[model samples]
Each structure stands twice: as C-alpha cells, then as structure tokens.
Target chain A: MKLQKPNDVMLQVSMRVITLFIFAFSFYLFLAGHNNPGGGFIGGLMTASAILVLYLAFDMKTITKAIPFSFTTMIGVGLLIAVATGIMSMLFGYPFLTHFFDYFLFPLFGEVELTTALFFDLGVYLVVVGAAMTIILAIAEDDK
Target chain B: MSNLVILPIIIPFIIGAVLIIFAKHHRLQRVISGFTAVGMLILTIYLAFLVYQDGNIVLEASNWPAPFGIVLVADMLATLMLLLTSIISTACLFFAFQTVSSDREKFYFYPFFFFLIVGVNGAFLTGDIFNLFVFFEVMLLSSYALIVHGGTKYQLRESFKYVIINVFASALFVVAVAWLYSVTGTLNMAHISQRVAELEQTGVINVIAILFFIVFASKGALFPLYFWLPRSYYGPPAAIAALFGGLLTKVGIYAIIRVFTLIFYHEPTFTHKGIIVTIAGFTMVLGVLGAVSQFDFKRILSYHIISQVGYMVMGLGIFTPLAVAGAVYYIVHHMIVKTALFLFAGATERITGTTDLRKMGGLIKTHPVLAWLFFISAISLAGIPPFSGFFSKFPIILAGFQEGQHVISGIALLVGLLTLFSMMKIFSYAFWGKQKHTSEQAKTPIGKLLLPIVPLVALTIILGIAAEPIFQYSLLVSEQIMDPSIYIESVLKE
Candidate 1:
C-alpha cells in the first residue's frame, strides 16, 4: 500500500520545531549515560520517538525520502559498533570488554574525557531507535 | 591465554551482527555464515585443547576482578559443551543452507542462527549468574524469530505459546536471581557459590534452589513443564528444529548441572537425591510415553528430547562422581545423535513432503544411505551397544543401582526400551513399508543434504568407538565440577 496522505498544517508545523528539541535532548541523554542514569537505551528510544513524531506529522513516503536508511541496517551498524568497542580490548591483550579512558584537551573546550564506552553506548542508542521504529512501522503497515 | 576464552562468544556475536548488514545477499550470507561456523568449530577445539592442557581459562571482562565484573570461564565441562555446540551448529548451519527457503533466508535466518550460537556459547561459558540470564534472553529472542520464520499459520500459533512460556520462565529466572542475590549478595556464580557455602542449603536457599530448578526445567523440557516441546519444535523448518533439538535444551541441562553442583550442593539428599531423583523418574517415563504415543516423525523426535533430557538430569540426580560423568557423557552423545535424527527427519520430509509416519514409507529401497545413517542414529539413541548412548547410559544406570536407587534406575531402563520401540516404530513406518511416494518424489536427490549430516553421524560413532578415552575425559570433567571449590578458587584467586 502506498503511504500517501493529505498534509496537516498544524501537526507538520508544530512537529518541525518540537522534533529538534527531542533530538537534542536525546543526544544529551545518550552522552550523559556514561556517568548518569541516562544512557544509550533510553537515548536511542528518545531519538526514535523524535523520528516517530516526524513520521506521524508527515506521510511515510515523505519521511522515507527525508530519512533514508533501512531500519535493519541501522540495527546492524549499532550492534557492530557496540561489540567492536569491547572487541578492541582483546586486540591489545586485554580481556574482552576492557574499556579504556583518557582525558584529552580540546581546542574549543578544556580537557575532555574520552572513553570507548561512549561508542558502546552510541551503538545501544542506535539499536534502540532502529528496533523501536522497525516494530512500529511493521505494525503500522497497510496490507499489501 | 585468557583472551582465547572470549573468542567463541565474540566470533559468533561479530559474525551475527555482520550478517545482518548483508541480509538480502543470501549467497554472501551463506558464505560468511558457513565460514564462521567452520571457524568456530576450529576455535572451540583449540580452546578445549588449551583448557585440557592448563586448566580453567578465565577472561575477566573489562579486566574487573571476579565478584565485581562479568567473567567467561572455560573449564573442561564448558569447553566440551562449546565443542559440541560448534559441531552440531556447524552441521545444522550447512543443512539449513540447503533446506531453509530463500524467503526465510532473506528474512535474516543466518544472522539469528549465529546469534543463537552466541547465546548458547555464552550461556555455557559465562561465570556470572546474571550474565547467564542475559545470554538466555539473547538465545530465546533469536529462537522466537527462528521458530516463527516461515510465518505459517501453525508456526505463528504455536510460537505464541512458545514465546509466552519462555517469557514467563525468564521472568521467574530474574525473580530467582533476585532472591539469590538477596541471600548471597553476589551475581558472580563463583562468588555466589562461595556465599552459598556460607549460607548453607537451608530454608530459603532450598526454596531458591527449587525455584532455580523450575526456571531451568522449563527451559530444559523436564517433566511436567515439557508440554510445549513437541508442538513448538514441530512448527519450525527441520534445520532450526535440528539446532533447537541439538543445542537449546542442552543449555538448560547444563545450567541445572552447573547450579546444582556448584551453588546448591549442601543437603544433597534433599535437593539432589530426593527432589531431582523423583523428577527424573517422572520426566523419563512421561516423556517416552509421549514419544510412544506420537505417530508424526518430528513430534516423536521432539518428545524423545524430553525423555533423553530426563536421562541427563538423572545422572545429576544420582549425584555420584560416576553418575555425573555419565551425565556429561550423555549430554555429548545426545547432542550429536539427536541432530542426526532430526536432520534425517528433515531429509525424509523433503523427499516425501510430509512428516506423518503413515504418509512415508519404502525410503529404504530408494534412499539406502539415508536409511542406514538414520538407523545408526536411532539405535545410538536407544542405547544399543558399541554406540555412544550405551556407554553414556551404562554408567548412569550402573551408578544408580550402586547408589541403591533401584526404582528410578528401573524407570530409566524401562524408558530406554520404550524409546527403542518408538524409534523402531518410526523406522518401520517411514522406511520399510510399501512405497508411499511417486517415483519422481522417491528419487529426489538428498545427497547434498546428507553431506552435512555425515559429520554428525560420524561423531556419534567416533564418540562410541573412543568411549574409553572420552569417558575418562568426562570423568575428569565430573571430578573438576563435582567439587565446587576448584571453580571458586580459580575465579576468586587474583
């Protein structure tokens, strides 16, 4: 079934602004996961919900044209990133999932703490978004 | 090195994730999955050899010391299980290549297959209890997809029940783990064992023991909880069925053995002898009865899984060194032979386009190779001499009598006879009757299919022929596991 729909001016206009904040908040949550309660899982869900709002305000065809990525490939990339973070340790003769961290000075900012776990969390965030959207779209689908 | 212990889980985990990106490229998926399976088989064999040489290989995940972080421990028993998982999964993976439909393959069958392996290997190798639960979920989630891959009306219907039952079990698992944590204050299995030793198998511990048993028994297809095995296993395509039959329930059995031996050892008469013995007797009798009552080829084999599981747990129930060794031996034998039988069922189903015993016959005249290979598997399953099953079962029954548990041992022996009867029933109905299929159907080529299964059949025979050394190896393993202190020390010693 084609996902054609008439535009709703208010949903479209309101979501265009609201979705950006949601995306920003999700990014904050995803980054904050390392030391705080907010981490990749919830972050990914936040991002997904933001995208979901976009899909809700726009037609699926339009949404597809705007955000063009297969949900499965997103999940795959996410898993690969998360697992690779752990696997990188083994290459250095450390046990699996042995994370590493260091404080590096930035040009724009003071010293910033960098860690492999952040990448791992990023992977989790992506997977959560991919999985949630995939489930929703699968259910929301019109009969073929 | 400790790093090697982590490879089995990582290999599958990485390959599974990679396969997802190429889901639509079925040929690439097959090539990559095929190579990964063979690579895993080699890696596990080498890992097992390392463990044999030096003892337990422990990888403290994230370099955290035991009691604080996740750990993967490859002891003799775990390494043996990894070896078996690699063998059966390698066979099933190849068999699946030929048998599973392209539509199903397109739906990410190969990725889920490796993820299932990730879960299985992780479950066997993890030294942390919570991680065990995590691995169980990974395995079950993939299975839920694989089971319902075809999306046939029957598959969807049956898998709903399967998913529900397992979800409920996983919930109870967390509950059991929580209660365990509350009592022991630890999530690391070795630490839990250390803590449980101090707590003793008293009132709450015994309750938790039984609760843990229930969680695992549901997964393992034991006794009263086995109602879902036959129907749900019947719904999937045969290769998935073969994989599930060969590896999944064995994980449950492995957990039972691990938990009972390590953490719940106090008051053996209560937990091991009294409760486990009675359950084993019932599981064996009722399971074979279910098999004997079934006429469909796959259903019979599915029900047989329950009965054979009873034998594995029976060894644990007996709780002697010999008995536990027999249990270990039984597990290895069953994983190989069961896969062979299921693949045979799959092979025959492909030719006749049906699994009902009454609907298939005279394959022996047309497919002699399939006929005899299946016969070896069937008899090995029945405990016939000079086969792996006989050697494996002999020690368990012998130990049972020596322990003077005559009634349960008698039940075990009687179940073996009934198992033979059911297998022969399958044989006579499916292979020996007048020709049932048309000439073209009868002549359908199964050589490629049979090629993948050959290794499984050969392993069962090799396991039998090499029973002397293999049984000795299992005895060593049983010795290693029967005393929990060895594990606790290996994990806790910095």
Candidate 2:
C-alpha cells in the first residue's frame, strides 16, 4: 500500500506558519506558568503538537534534521533536574521539593521573582515534550 | 532522623533517572545499577534497625505536617518490607546481569527496574492513601514496560491482558479512595484510621471495605481473579518472573493487611471472619488444585503462589495477634523461598532448555547442588516441619482451632497436604526420573544463577532455626498494627 501525502501547497505552508505560532505560544505558557494556569505539561504538549504538525506537513528526513537531540536524553535530563531540585531542599534541612522565592528589580523588566518551582516546571516541560515526541515519532515511523 | 524514611524511595528514583542517561553503555549501566542496589540494601537494613530500636519514623514532605501533606512513614512493618524488597531486587538484578539479553539491557531495562523498586518502596512507606494509589501506578507502568521488554509474540499478547486487568483495578482503586476521602475528609492513612475508629464500622463503610478488598484481591491474585497469573508470568524471563513472583503480589497482600488492621477493623466479625475466612478456604483449595494439574515447572510455581497467598489471608482472617504474627512470618518466609524456587526453575531451564516436567529428568544426577537447594525451598513451601513454612503456618492453624473455627483449620491442613503432593510431583518428575535431555545439554554451567538462589535457601533455613525470635518480632509488629491509636499518635503528634 502506498501512503498518501498532502499535495496542497497552501495547506502545507499554512500549517508551517501555524506550527511556529503554536511553538511561540507554548513558550509563553511555560514562562508564565508559575503564576498562572499554564505550566510545563500543557506547554510541552503544545510544543510536541507543533512538531507533529511539522511532521504532517513535511517529510521524516526534514523533521529528523530539525530535531537533532535524542528524545531519551531529554527525558533523562528532565528527570534528573526535577529530582535534583527536590534534593536541593534536603541540603538546607528542608523536606524534598520545598521551593523558595525572592523578588528583585530587573534592568528592563519591572520586577521578577525567581522561584525554584520554575526550574521544576521546566523539567516537567522537557519530560512531557520528550515522552510525547518519542511516542509519536515511533508510531509514525512504524506506520511508514 | 525522620527524614530517613524517604531515602529508600528517593535513592531509586534518582538512580533510575541517571541510568536512563547511560542506556547505551551496558557495562557502565551494570556497575552503577549494581552499586545502587547494594547501597539500597545497606540503607534499608540500617532503616530497619533504626525502626526496631527507636520505633516509627514519619517524615512530612516539604515540612507540611501530617494530614495536609505527603508523608513517608517507616514503622516496623514498612522497614521490614523495604529490607526484603532491597534483598530480592539486588538478587534479581544480579541474576538479570547474566540472563537478560543485551537488547533488553540497552532498552532502559535497568532504569525501569529501579523505577519499579521506587514504586514498591514508596507504596510500602507512604503515609497517605492517595499517594499509595500514585505509587501503585508508578509500579504498574514500570511493570507493564518490563513485562514486554523483549516484545516477543507471547509477551505482547499476555501483557495486554495483564495491563487491561490492572488498569481496571486501578480505576476501581481511585473510586475507592475517592469514596473514602469523601466520607472521612482526609487522605492521610493515619488520619483516616483515626476518623474510622471514631465513627465505627457502618454498613456503608463495610461496603467500601469490600470494594477495597476486591481491588487488592485482583492485584494479589486471589481466587476468581488469579486467572491472569499463570499465563502472564510464563512469558517473562526467569529473573523477571522470579522478581514478580516474589514481590508484586505481596504488595497487594501488604496493602490488605495494612488497611484492614488499621482502618477497617471495627467490624471484624462480618468482614474478617465471615468473608475473609471463606475466601481463604476456597483460594487455598482452588490454587493447590491448579498447581496439581500443571505439567510445566513455572506454571506449577505460579499456581502455588495463589495457594500460599490463601494461607497468609487465612492468618489475617483468624485475626488474632498470634495469627497476624504468623501471617507476617509467612510473608517473610514465602518471599525468600518463592524467589529461590523460581531462580531454581530458571537454572533448570537453562540446563534442560525446557520448563516441561515430562521433557526434563534426572537433574539431581547432574546438578546435585541446584536440586538440593530446590528441594529445601520446595519442602519449606509445602509447610514441612523443621522448615520456615511450618513455623509460619503453625500459629495460624493453631489460632484457627483454638478459636473453634474447626472447618477452616481442617481445610488449611488439607491444603497443606495437597501442596506437598504437587511439590513432590515436580521433584519426582523433574529431578529423579530417567534422563530425558542429552548429557551435553545437562552440562550447561549454572554457577552464576545459583549464586543468588543459595543465599535465599540459607535464609529460609535460618528463619526456621531462629523461628522463636522472629516470631517474637512479628508478634510485636502485630500488636502495633492491631492498635490504631499508636499509629495515629505517632503520625499526627504536634
């Protein structure tokens, strides 16, 4: 059986543009996650969906070149970072995952509070992206 | 000091994550995972000793005290389980080093292995009921992956059933937890126990109790729910099968013991005596009958797992301090002996190239050491005198007879005979009959495999000889478990 590819140039180009916008919005969600409803899980998922859209629009060779880092490494690093953040609390005689925050005036931005939870969120984001992408890519590759 | 309670869980999670990075380096992965397993064993032993000397240790995660946050608790029972888990995991990991294929190794097997440990240890130690469900998911997911590690046709097919059944049970688990929280307004196990004691056991609560029982019974492979065990367990390699046989179902039994003794004890007559005792009898008889009918070595062991589970539940059903102590002792004995038996079966399969009893014979002539070790474990499993099984079963049956539950006691005795009959059938057919395999095949080296089985066999013998002291310890554990006030006070103290 032959696989069908989307032949419409307009649909392909529009998907590419929409994928970029979704990627940007996902980053926005991740950045504002600590103070709002959006966080690592949803953001990472959005990022994966954007990549999926690219895969749908383009060929496997093109997308493989675009994402060079291995998914396994992403998952490993994400988990390590998350666990390390929790262990860091133990170093200060606090229980695991005890987050600390402090507010400081930035040069350009008005004020920013750096919280350990953001790093934890970042770890979750990476893991979500890595796991979802790995699964999607494997299934797609198997289908081909 | 209370922080020590979390180490068993954290160490594994960290090691598993790090192992994922070295997935391609088999030698590096083995060294790091080996070191981690031994380190965990040492830490678990120290934790058990601390609990023995100093009493329960409770750590509220992120300093959020008692009912409000996740907590890890290391009482005697929890520490004992942690110690046993580390022991079996270390043994199984070493065995896997020899047996598991290189492909499986490179596929993040070790990471999933440690992750499974994290789940088991977390389930054992968690003070909150909801976190227990979360830990169960962690364990189940890892298990689902590991069961299909090689992804053979048989593995993929059987693991589908295993996964589907467990997913259903997991959904039921969530519903049970939701109902319990709604009624008590607390997810912390210690807090819930306090609430349940105050309210006493109502009919609605009893319904919830049975619901929880059903969830755990499926996981524990009790009667009517054990249809998945024999077939699914047959697909994995021997090392993995041994680990699952030894540790997984026992977790379900541990949960049942913990919840029933601590939170749902107000109506023991209806729940424990009436329902549990009857189930215990049927589980024993049915399991042994299944074992007696199996012609394969691994399948026989699988069926025996169900039968042995019935004995432990019977001890719990009897519900005396002495009887619960016997159940505790039985768990320790069974975990060691069952893993040893499975390891022996693996060693035999390595030599004979088959698990069928009819196709294998006269192994004792060629591998006397392996055969003897298997013999010891077999007798111990069958409740023979002067072995670990006898001492464990003695108190439970004695307690049954003393309480005037003569029929259940008689059933226990009958099941013991049937268990011996099946075990002897394996011994005579596989070890003592005429040689069926070629001499070349029988000469296969099994030294590496026997290395793990020997320690477990020795432990069973030691447990039998030193039964008095161990029984005393179990008695103490039972006493602590029977009284919920002490557990609540220890966890909720301001």
Candidate 3:
C-alpha cells in the first residue's frame, strides 16, 4: 500500500524528534522502572518506535544500510546479557538470580545502590529494541 | 548446577548465530549444525540427570531475587520436556537434511531451526509467566518463517492466516498477562500461587484463569481454536511439519498444565474439573472426527494432535495424582510417537510423491521397515497394548474409572477405538494396498530416511517395555504438581 499523502521534510523531521523523545523518555522510565512505574518492555517499545520514525522518513534500503546487521546480533547479545545476570548470582553462591549488591559513593552523584535487577532490565531493553527493529525492517523491506 | 539448567538454552542461541556466518557453505553449515545438535542431545541427557540429582534449580536473571527478577526453573517437568524436545529436534533436523530443498538450507532455515530450539527450551525453563510469553513469541516467530520457507502459493496463503492468528493470539497473551499482573501483582509463578491462595475468590481469579485458558487453548489448538493448524501445517515440508506437529502445540499444553495446576489452583469454580473435562471430551470427539474424514496422511496426524491433547488435558482436569501422572506420561509418549509418525508420513511422501492416502499403497511389500515403524506408532497412537501409547492412555482411563467418572472413561475408550480405525485406514490406504506409485517414484530409498526414525521407534518400544519405572516417575511428577505447596515453598521460601 502506497502512502496517499506526500512527504514533507519539516513534518518528517518533527516526527523524528518525537520518536527520539519517546525513545529517551522510555529509557529514563526503564531505569526508574524497578521501584517506580516504568519497565523494560515499555522502554524497549519506545526504542523501536524511534526506528519506526526513521523508516517512515526514508525508504527501507537506506534504513537497512544505516542499521547494518547489528539488530540481529544485538538480539543475541541482549539475551545473553540477561542470562549472564542470572548466572552472576550463582557464581556468588546465591540461589539462581539472587539479587545482591550495595550502595556506594560516586564521582558525579552522591550515593546509590546498584542491583543486578537493573542489569537484567537493561538486557531486556536491548533485546526488545533489537527484536522490534528486526521485525519492522524485515516487514518494511518486504513491502518495498 | 546452572550449567545443567541454562546450557541447553544457550547452546542453541550460540549455534544459531554461528550458522548465519556460514550461510555460503551449505555442507559445512549442515555438518556444524549436526555436531551441535549431537552436543545438545548429550547436554540434555546430562542436564536431565543434574535435575534428577539436585531437584528443581532456579536461575534468576541479573541476580535479582524472587518477586523482582526474571527466573528460570528446571524442575522434573522442565527437564523431562527438555529431554523430549532435544530428541525431537535432533530427529527433525536430520530428517530435514534429507527433505529440505538445498535452496532453503542456504537461506534462513538452519538459523531459524536453532532459534526455534532456543524458544522451546526457554519456554520450558522460564519461571516467570511473562517470560513464557516472550519465549512463546520467539518460537512462533521462527515457526512462521519455517512454515513459509518454501514460499509456494499454497504455503504463502495458508501461512498468512497462520501468522495473523498467532499474532492475534500473542496480543491476547500480553493482554492476559497484563490482567494476571494486575490481579496478582507478581509475575513469578510461585509468588502468584502464594498470593492467589491468600485471596481465594471464585469471582476474579476465575476470570483471570479463563482468560489464561483462552490464550493457551488457541495456541495449543484445542477444539474450536484448531482451525488454523491443519491448513497451515500441511504447507510445510514433511520434516518441518513433523516438528511442528510434535513440538509446537505441546508447548502450549505444557504452559497450561504448569500455570493452571501451580499458580491458578485457587479457583476451582472456574477452571476446576467441570470446565476442563467438558472441553477435553469435545476436543477428543471433534478431533477424531476430523481425522476420520481426512483423505491425506499428514492431515489425519494433524487432527490427531488435537485428540491426543485431549487425553493429556483429561488427566489434568481429573486433578488426581494418577490422572496427572497419566497426563505427564501421555505427553512424553505422544511426543516421540507423533514425531515418528509424522516423519514416516514424510518418508511416504518421499517415496510416493504424495501424502494423499488414496494415492498410496503396498509399501508393506516394498519397504517393510517403513510399514512396521508406521504400524508401531500408529497402533500406539490408537492405544494398543504394550506400545507405550497403551500404557500412557491406560492409566488416564483407569484414573477416570477410579475417579468414578465412568462416562468420561467410556468416551475415552470410544475415542481410542476411533483412533485405531483412523490409523488402520492410513495403513491400509497408504501402505497396504497394491503398489500405487509409478516405477520412478518407488526408486527413492526409504532406508536413508529411516535413520532419523530408528531412535524414536526404539524409544517407543523402550518406554513400553520399561513402563513401570517411567510410570512411577510420572506419578512422582504428578504428586509434586498436585500438592504444589512444596513447589511454591521452594520457590518463594516460607
């Protein structure tokens, strides 16, 4: 199905920024997700939407060249990262996925605790972005 | 310990990606994959023992503790399914080498095959329900590619419906998970079980349980939800079709058994014996009728997938240790035998160049090995004695009798008879009639193909001959599921 409306550079640029904003906001939400309201899934979808913005502005071949083979590989990497976080606790003699860590002083920031759960959430975020990109790109290419 | 729990899932992910780089070298790709599959088979056996020795082991992602982090648990059930999945995957991959056109192997087939295994193993091991949905999508996505790999018009048309229906089901799965999360506030199965037990209400829990049932039922191809299955499955090559026939829907049934028995047991009012048993009876009857009416060999086996699922669900719905044992036993036996039968269908397709029963015949005289193997699996599927199928079905039916559900027992017996009739129809039409294929078609060697089937046939025999120990183990698994307080306590820590 061809788009009925012609593309405008200004409109496309605005869509791009909106998509980028959603992606950034989603990442912020994901980082705060464990204790606050947002999560890995919502954050991942936001990242995917950013790519969607690019696809809309340009044809698929350009988008494909821009991304290269990273999306597929990143999917594997993200899943491995998620699994690695689970295995980390086993190495520490905790039961599977046992979250343990401590608060520490930082250079730019005062004090905060870093937990394994955040790492797992980040893994989830990466996988979501990669998988969503793969799907959108594959479908878009098929359309072209 | 974590190696046993996580390696099988990880190995496939690694191998699948590696295969992508070797896309230009078809022979090298096939050889490397074959080695990896053998390695996986060994890993699966070793893992099964590790689980057997250590009991259920949980791996929490990113060191996040329960109720917070995603966890993967390898219990008796998970390991058993893993073992079965590896066996079926190895067989199907070898079968694919013989059948999958050279063009496809060079394409995305090998990578997706590994991806499919990654998804299956992930689904089996996942402790979080939401993670289960994610893995389910992974598996379904891979299957969508494999089904339409050949890109024939027939395949494209059918797979389009298949993809749309599954996409809809996946969306529904997310919606159901959202509802479930809202209700329980925890995605961990063990935590959900504990919380659900505290609030024991038939009103809302029942709604959530039924919502879950809807999601799995569609995926598992139960009764009214099975329309897309036969049409779409018939389009794939025999090997891929056999793999889907054996493994895909069973994963759905596995999830249902895991969730309903463990987490959602609070409300018998909605999911209890009444609702499930009714569905089981209808699923069995309708499935067999569909099989009886089909003139094609693959189509018959596809319908029988629904029928066999009914038996497993009946065991669950009965909600007794014996019945659940029967269900567990039935799942193992069906996985092996069903894959074998489907492969045999593929073999016949290779020899005769058709899957239509009417166009096939007299394989018994020419290829007695194929005939006998089909006979073993078919008769077993029909619930014949000493063939593993009988042992699996016998307990469930006996459990029905013991539970005083004589009516269901009778219906089950009737379904068994119809199953036998349908199998015999395939035998007589496809393998027993006068030779129907032309001379050129008959020249194809059935022996090379039989290599993939020999292990499954041996397993069916071994399972039957050693039914006592296997039956006892299944009983043990059933005991754990029925009382699941232990599972809950173990995961959640009293």
Candidate 4:
C-alpha cells in the first residue's frame, strides 16, 4: 500500500499550484452558495482534495508537519458553528435554522446581502473537509 | 412551547460536539456528559408532561410552513418514546462509565454516544420522511463507530456485517421515501397521510407501503431479516449491546407504527392482519427457538430481543385500541427491562470474565444481589405475574383473543412459555449449578455497575404496580394514533 512517488519534479510543482487553485475555487463556491449553485458540502470537499493533493505530493511526515491541528477538531468546530446558527435563530424566537437575510449599501461596493444560512453552509463545509481528511489520513497512515 | 420539541434532538447534538473537544479529558468528559444526560432526561420528562396535557406540539423548522418546511412533532407517542430513550441511554452511559475501557473513552465514545442519541431522538421527533432518513443515517453512522470502538478482531468482523446490512436498509429507506414522495408529492408525514387518505388504497400505494414495511422490518430484525442482530450484537461490549438491544430496533418499530397507523391504515385486513400478523407469528416462533438454542448469556438475550419485538408487532397486528395500547406498553417495559438485563450481563461478565454459560456458574452463590436482580428481570421478561411484562403482554394477548385471532394469541402464549424456559436455562446454567470457574474468577466490586440497573429494575416494578395509569396513557396514545385525523389537523391546521 506504499504511495508511489512521481520522479518528475514538474508533477509535484504543478500539483501544488492546482491544489491552491482548487482551494480558492472551493471558497468561491462556498461564498456564492446562498444565491448560486455551490455550497458548503461541495466547497468543503474541494478544500479537502487540496489537502489530499498535498498529501499525495509530499510524504506523510511533511504533510503532518504542515497541518498540525487535529482533523477531528475541525469537525467539532464545524458542527458547533452549524448548530449555533440554528440555536441563534431559536434565541431570536424563531424556529431552529430559520435564516435571516439583509442587504447593506457601502461606499466602495454597490451592495452586499448576508444570510445566516451562509454561516451554516460554512459550518457544513468545514465538517466535510474535516471528516474527509480524517478518513484519508487515517487510511494513509495505516498503510505505512 | 413548540420549540421544546426540537430541544431533545439539539441538546445532544451540541453536547456531542462539545464532548469531542474534551475527548482527552476523560473525567471532564464524563462529568459533562453525565450532566447533559440528566438535563436531557428532565427536559424530556417535562416535554412528555406537556404533551400529555396539551395534545401534540409541532415546531416548523426555520419558520417554514407546515407542508413546505421540516417540522418536529411531539405527540403522545413520540414524547413517550423520547422519555423512554432518555432513560435507557442515561443508564447505559453510567454503566459504560463503570465498564468501558479508558482507551475507548479517549477514542471519542461519549461524543458518538450523544450523537447516537441525537439521531434516535431526531428519528422519533421528525415530521418529515426525508428527515427520518437523515436521522437514521446519523444514528447508523455513530452506531457503526461505536460497535467497532474497541477494534477487536471480533468487533471488526461483526460490525462490518452490521454496517453493510444497515447501509443497505438505509438505501432502501431513501428509495421508499423517494417512491412515496413521487406518488404523494409531499414529504411531511401528516400531509402524506392526508394525501394517502385521499388517494385511497391504490395498488401503487399498497406497494409503497409494503416497501416501507420491508425497510423498517429489516431494521427491526423481523424473522428472516434478523440474521445480522445476534452475532453483531454479541461482538460489542455489553453496555453497547444493551443500548442497541434497548433502543435501536425500537426506532424501527416506532417508524413502522407511525407510518402504518397514520398513512397506511386504509387496508388493515391485508397489510396489518395478513402481512403483519404473519410476520409477527414467525418472528415470535423463530426468535424464541433461536434463544432456546443459544448457550451464551448475551446471545440468548439478543435473540430474545427479536422474539419480544414479535409481541409488540403482534399487538399492532391485532389492530385494536387495547392491542396498540398493549404494544406501546410493551415497548416501554421491554426497553427498560432488556437494558437492565444486559447491564446485569456486563456485571456478571466483569466478575466471571466470560459470557459463556457453560464456563460460568455459581454466580448466585458468589454475587447473590446480581443474581436476584437478574432473576426478577428474567421472570418479568418471561411475562410472570406482578411484573411489568405480564401486564403489558396480558393486554395484547387478551386483545388478540377478543378480536378472534385465536391462533396468533395462542402462538404468543406459547412463545412466552419458551421464553421462560430459555431464561431459566440461563439462570440454572450460569448462576445455579456447580462453581465452574470459581477458582479463576475475580470478585470485582459491582457497586457502580449496580447503580444503573437498580433504577431500571425499580421502574419495571413501578410500571407493573401502577399499571392502571400507564395503561390509560397508552390507551390515549393508541386512540390518537388509531385516528389519524387528530395528528393531521394538529400538524397541518386544515
């Protein structure tokens, strides 16, 4: 089950670059999710893949040094954030997970609309990323 | 007030997340989880009281209208089940505190336990079918983790089967939900019921109903589908096995009762009488036979869970108010007693260091207290007089006779007799005869373990002595369920 490393240096460099691009695109998907197609689940998977690419390009030891925090903590935080948004709505005398949206006008930007659901989606994104990484890392480590 | 309905589901979810962070601090994790379980129990009891007084309480999630958004409903049955779930889970948690290894504790057992609760409560409370599927996944995912927590070879092998079977059932559940949605165009239960009533018993509707039954019955471990239960359950620690024995299949039973009564009642003769009654009869007969053949402590009890579930479904099959009431009563009684019995098994295992009845003996001489406690629960499980099991079973059998289902009632009585024989087999072999392993056995103090079992044993007795009020409550619950109009109007407001 040893991971086969590519001999070519160009492959590793290109993988790193592609990983960054996917990470940024996932963020874009997550932010535009409330009004558009992409949301937390897909965005989170994209981010996890970026990390996965890093794991693929680098050795397990180097990747562990790069990401020091426990992946499970990300899951816990993501779940807390998602549940907190629901509880926040409950605190405002609304049902759980009831989203509220409002638009504000700014001098620099024309207008921006914010929704509580976006934060909920962010929480979902983090959980997906964390859960995916946990499984992948565990499997990869087990192979070693 | 309606918001209270969602608290049972949410409180656990929040606690589970928090416990994940404190996973390394075992003592702190125990304290936090203990307080949360107690708090949730109190909250569930209060909610049950409110529902008992004020009829059904429905909370539309995110302020979505009834049919348009997800809702959590706490009617008599749901709240009743919620109360029972909280009681058993709390007991199991405390029992785990005494018995679960520190290694498992550090591996996030408490978090997964709470998550399992979140899933169970969510399954009982959700008003939408799709939400039920989601909650089932949550429960199954945590169960998959918990069942294999120790990662023993036996645990790994058995849990793999358990996971595969449940995953298949879950997929079938989603397919059933999708088919029903395609047919009825609504996911909300009450709305679907209304549509089902309007559509009458079309062949497509009946097919969908049968599909749903197969999905839940597999989860509930009915007859042929119960192959995964005994071996899989035998692999986990007794505390986990107890929790699964007590609550997991009952969730499936709860779903069956909810859907059959609310949405698929139009053709009782075929679905309830023909199909369910037949399954109930076989489930009882085969389950008891399996139990009678088992030579291990937990394996026998695991088989008995399937057997006892047959009685509950038989009550539903009888399809009378008294019968359904009896089924409800049986659920409450069975959950408490079965969990207590398993906890007792765990305590005995701790002392003797084995689950094999052949290798274990003289527990009655060594630990008279544990022996007596097991005796009481065993007899109660066997439907002996002056215990909760007898009273709960009495109504179902009586109702079966009254309804002229003589053969099914006769089968129920016969199964009860076999159940007694098997329990006594366990008693004599494990507790009574010569001290088979007395020289090798350690006299581990079980005071902490006994703490959880005592309340459950007491509750079983109280449920028996105070059967009048409990019976009346079950009747009220049955009436509300038997007549779906109340549930529909309360939820949909049309």
| Candidate 2 C-alpha error for residue B46, in Å | 0.2
Q: Could you give candidate 2's per-residue lDDT for residues B1-494 as a string of tens digits?
A: 35678889989998998898889999999999999999999999999999899889988887887899988888898899999999999889998999898999999999999999999999999989999999999998999999988999999999999999999999999999989988999999999988887888897789889989999999999877888999899999998999999999999999999999989998989999988888888888999999999999999999999999999998998999989999999999999999988888888889998999999999999989888889999999999979999999999999999988899999999999998999999999999989888989877888878898888999999999999999999999889898877788889984
DockQ of each two-chain model = 0.78, 0.67, 0.23, 0.74
Candidate 4: stretches off by over 4 Å: A1-8, B439-442
Worst 10 residues of 3 chain A by lDDT: A92-101
lDDT of 4 by residue, A1-144 (tens): 766766868767899889989989999999989888999999999999999988888778888898888889999999999999999999889888889999989789779998999989989998999999999888888874
* Docking level of model 4: medium
TM-score (C-alpha) between model 1 and the true structure: 0.98
Residue range A31-103, candidate 3, lDDT tens digits: 8788788878778888788778877886666777887766766776777777677667766766555666688
lDDT of 1 at B254: 97
**Tens-digit per-residue lDDT, B336-426, candidate 3:** 9999999999999989889999989998888888898889889988988888999999989998999887887888999999999999999
Q: Mind giving the per-residue lDDT tens digits that candidate 1 earns over A1-144?
A: 767656689989999999999999999898888888899999999999999999889868899999878998999999999998988888898888889889999999899888889999988988899899999999877544
lDDT of 1 at B425: 98
Q: Please provide, for model 1 over B365-388, each residue's C-alpha lDDT reduced to its tens digit, 9 standing for 90 to 100.
A: 999999999999999999998899
Question: How far is B60's C-alpha from truth in model 2 (Å)?
Answer: 0.5
lDDT of 4 by residue, B453-486 (tens): 9999999999999999999999999999999999
Please identify which of the two predictions, 2 or 3, would achieve the higher TM-score against the true structure.
Answer: 2
Rank order (by lDDT, best first): 1, 4, 2, 3
